[model samples]
Target: MSDYVTYDESDHVVTLTLNAPEKRNAISTFADCDAVVEAVRRVNRDRGVRAVILTGAGTAFCAGGDLKAMRDRKGIIEGSHADLRENYRRGVQAMANALYECDAPTIAAVNGPAIGLGLDVACMCDIRIASEKARFAESFIKVGIVPGDGGAWLLPRVVGMSMACELSFTGDQIDAATAKEIRLVSRVVPHDELLPAARALAARIAANPPEMVRMTKRLLREGQHMRLSSLLEISAAYQALAHSTEDHKEAVSAMLEKREPRFTGR
Candidate 1:
């Protein structure tokens, strides 16, 4: 219910837009990331929401964690209240984990600047599509702090260790085209068409069976680290699970009939 975060649904896609554009969509001192977790949870289990697209309102997608908020957190740490800092740390990590574990397909439509915590959020998503106006940076080094949330873990996996090191160490921003070239984002569209493109992609994903889609995402994330033989074993188990769904029967029947299968996600 944060005024800073707006949630809406179109067809089967749920969109969460960072609504605080006036401060360059900075998710600072306010409870912005916590609000995001709630919104995503609301959409995650909702049968009507088969896919999700995350973006920012106004100019920049997010200027990263509100610097002012970080300052306040530093003040708390300096106060020698160890318990308080630990509790706050858990809250922040929860927000990052929510973005990572969201069951449906998650897309970050980076319509503008993404710095610090903003980069964490974008990397947590399953896919990223940026606008030509988008600018990306891992700004922790510039502020003389390590990435407080999940950036340390996610960046290296998205980009290789060497490239991730360079970005985090320098804190220089990269343009959308460069982001795509580095595989930080999958595609870059014009600013005006960013949301439209994201929504179109969401629709295409939502057209598939929800059960299979969820399993496919789970398989990719959980299976990435396993050996080839392990993956083959797990993949067969996944296919067995997929075969139990009514959507699978419909797909087979439709193939036999030479028609498109309309999956109900049941």
Candidate 2:
């Protein structure tokens, strides 16, 4: 919606690109936060969208907060202590919620450095694909601030508590290889091949029945905080709904006929 973020859709995949290349795609202003949340909302409600990819426009995937803004007390940084807490709630935190709650599977194609809030943004995605030039850090500490955008919760879930603690405490940037080794990114490709790799994975995910894909993602998200018994109940309900869809019937019929399934996302 804003110049801070741009949206594109093709072949059942929606791509949301952070557009402020001059700022290294920083989520500094309210418009930046709103643009991301709006884009995620759009993709979530579009049943035709089976998957989504998030990336940046230029060299850096996202450099996180605009240090200039912080120094000048402009953008999100311009506020009293209570005002700043509220700003986090309605701004960056809301963006994180929109992303994590999105129905379509999300892949973050980290083209370059993803620091602080940017790193947290990548962690919010279900999958991460990084460029060879990509780097990552839970860098809030470096700025004498903590993760105000839910990084404390999201990062630990992504890279595990010990590794997350190490990154957050030190605010050290890690190479793409180290990110992959720590499970921060599922794949690392050449800088030029980043988007293609992410799209290929998205296409693979999109080939499935769309409703099933969404429901499966929902189940996975629920399982993260749910007990085994509660998750099983939720899974059973979702399975019933999935089994009753026309796409499920088509899938089975196509298998029986030895043909590729054509799903209508019913």
**Candidate 1 structure quality by residue, lDDT tens digits, 69-114:** 5577642233356755664465557778888889899999998999
lDDT of each: 0.84, 0.92
The residue-by-residue lDDT of candidate 2 on 1-266, one tens digit each, is 47788899999999999999998998888889999988988887788999999999998999999999999998888779999888888889999999988889999999999989999999989999999999999999999999998899999899899999999999999999999999999989999899999999999999999999888999899999999999999999999998899999999999999999999987
Lowest summed lDDT window (length 10), candidate 2: 38-47
The TM-score between candidate 1 and the true structure equals: 0.92
Backbone N/Cα/C clashes per model: 1, 0
Best candidate (score: TM-score): 2
Best-performing candidate as measured by lDDT: 2
Error of 1 at 207 (Å): 0.8
Q: lDDT of candidate 2?
A: 0.92
Candidate 1 regions off by >4 Å?
72-88, 227-230
Q: What is the total number of backbone clashes in candidate 1?
A: 1
